[model samples]
Target: MKEKEILINWMEEGMTSIPNVLLKNYRRLQLNETEMMVLLHIYSFSQKGISFPSFEDLSGLMTISSSDCAACVKKMIQKQVITIEQGEQTGYEFYSLTPLWNKIAALFESDARGESLQQAMTEEKDLYSLFEEEFGRPLSAIECETLALWIDQDQHDPAVIKAALREAVLSMKLNFRYIDRILFEWKKQGIKTVEQAREQGRKFRKPANTEQVSRSENAVPFYNWLEQ
Candidate 1:
């Protein structure tokens, strides 16, 4: 036979479409090689309009015995990976892969959430290191708890917290009480970004009624959040 004729014959033999996710994650789904092959055969048969192929039919295409094929199908049903339902109109039993697809989708969502949590933990660790470096001392347990509360309870952005720390340092306060006050004030004012914090500081530092507060020539102007 010519190559073209062979190719045409192969094309006419038809193809089976399987989800890439199913192929990649079959092992994770707890399907062994034989079981996976059985599922593939069932799917192929279904594509050809065989909704429920018998154990003999399944065994014919596989190296396993008919009894083994039946056992595998029973195990899959027990695992809730596949289900058999009777058609209402036709009254014929058919296999449904909805449970398997749902399991795969749930696994993907769980993996995404796990990745997000891991990223959040890494960012929190870096933020803690930055705080320790700026303070020139390790954070006390209470200080650590306070920082966690800011991120978890108050939902303060890490960048905004860093900006508040900068404000405290500029004022020569360099204390948690001062920094906490700055954060509280910012939150009350609905300030959520570094630019908004800077703008707030500028507005507060602007001289009122042409009366400037006296300070040393080298002193950097900083918002005294305690007085506010």
Candidate 2:
């Protein structure tokens, strides 16, 4: 038989689809906004022939402080969410989401051994397939385990969650902490069924169902009316 082939769909504008496989790692690693931002920055920079950027560049681009950036980088490195390589810059480090990237790619070809991406990623398989293929290797151990655990817990793909995140970001520009909290809350509430999500929306709208009341003018004082 010929070797298995993998195909991923083209990225859509404003698509927030991150591989669902990373959710567990996301929580375990305690990946905050700055850290996640840095990883994504490195991922994007890699495309432009810049695989590793110093902490300075990362902080600068993400509009954060040097100390803050360094702290986040240290955390990512400690968690194995990213790898740091020394370079010309002080405290230089390189970061990548290699493990997450691979799991996303494997979404197309289900492995019978462990947690299956087949279920969570089926709806948005194309969205992540090629991305995984692009970042084939060089994954760290922590990321791999994190990916697997997250994949195990996820009944939904990152694609849908991303769309919701993007909408929330655009509307409220909430930080990653808020996004994670929201996802956690939604999952805890058993929002698996579409009908359940819809019903929740309906329930949420109940408070807004308040009837509009025209402003009532204050009654004029009796003495004031007499004076007039």
Candidate 3:
């Protein structure tokens, strides 16, 4: 019964709640173990209705000296993890963790954006590999630059670019200039999808006059995309 009473007394002493996000990401926020402990002590004091705990009060709860505690608090303020705000009483101040929470929110947003960018990069790399496989050699720097221009500057869809590459291969052109001409012609015709490109190919296969039929018989099986 005496031990049970002691446990009840400990429970009644109250608890301090720390944010799980801060505990998980404190190191990433550039805070060392000692600095983290100092922040925890301040949080505990705030929970108990003490807005600002002195260096002596912090030091009593920590293993560090009072001077060291003061230094840690100063560094945290400089890092913008905490701020000293004016209190209700003149000449009095309190530590606020608003800046620290803002930093954590920014970090979360950056991580989410980073993930999206990484996935895009992975898809672009796969597209490059497909080009290398078709050409049977790694692309030259100029060739890679041309491909990037098609995607970034020309705003061509990757699927459409792949369809243009297939057309170039079928015509036995198998060169960057010929593939670029195909893409230019498709863009001028407002072709935006693989299906649209295939429809254009079907139209090219049908000869309107005897002159076009004679030319087709003289050349390879594929349509000459450059002539169009």
Candidate 4:
């Protein structure tokens, strides 16, 4: 085909326009340029009815090697940026971009919420910073997402979340899973505030304290009654 004809034919076929939001915030999703390009190519292929592309096919469209492409795909799967679902008719597993779309949709929703979104972003960022400061290192993307879900999906107040973190810190377990368990237990008990959390802690200790006092009282009762 002539260069002009090739250009015309390609244009006639159509174009791929990535979501601007995705392009703008790719780094926040921990996607490197190569990974982003690979994802974009996969999206293009999916749109063109090629849902599952081999590493060689992916590497053909870019400068990356098949090894690198496979690595990127594995990393994305680990981070939950991509998932594999069984294809209906073929029974083959295909990479699904639903998780990626969900993250992008969350970003757009946050953007649409205006000031509340800004405040939420600030609060969530601050919470991550606080956890990192306590843990003495940066949080992984998964850890950050876990914290965000606590606030957004679980409807846990930031103060209550902080309280749980504090409890974890004091207990010498400054990890996301430990904090998550604390929050889970608090939710089960309907503890929705920092004060309620403190009250619940006291309630748990109260029983032990009362038991200790009862044991002491019982030990002295026989001798004390005889003396009286």
User: RMSD for each model, in Å, please?
Assistant: 3.1, 27.1, 5.6, 16.4
Off by over 4 Å in 3: 1-7, 87-92, 113-117, 155-228
Instruction: List model 3 lDDT by residue over 57-89, tens digit each.
Output: 999998899999999999999999999999676
> Which prediction has the highest TM-score against the true structure?
1
lDDT of 1 by residue, 1-228 (tens): 999999999998789999999999888889998889999999998898999999999999988899999999998898888999999999999999889999999889999999989988988898899899999999999999999999999999888888888887877889889989999999998999999998887776564533344544455666678987
lDDT of each: 0.89, 0.51, 0.90, 0.81
lDDT tens digits, residue span 50-106, model 2: 777776877788788878778877777686666655657666554555654554455
Better of 1 and 3 by lDDT: 3
- Ranked by TM-score from best down, the candidates are 1, 3, 4, 2
lDDT of 3 at 193: 94
Tell me the TM-score of model 1: 0.83
**C-alpha RMSD in Å of predicted model 3 compared with the true structure:** 5.6
Query: Across residues 74-106, which tens digit of lDDT does each residue of candidate 4 receive?
Result: 998887899989978999978899999898888
Stretches of candidate 1 off by over 4 Å are 1-6, 193-219
Clashes of 4: 0
- Ten-residue region with minimum lDDT total, candidate 1: 209-218
lDDT of 1: 0.89
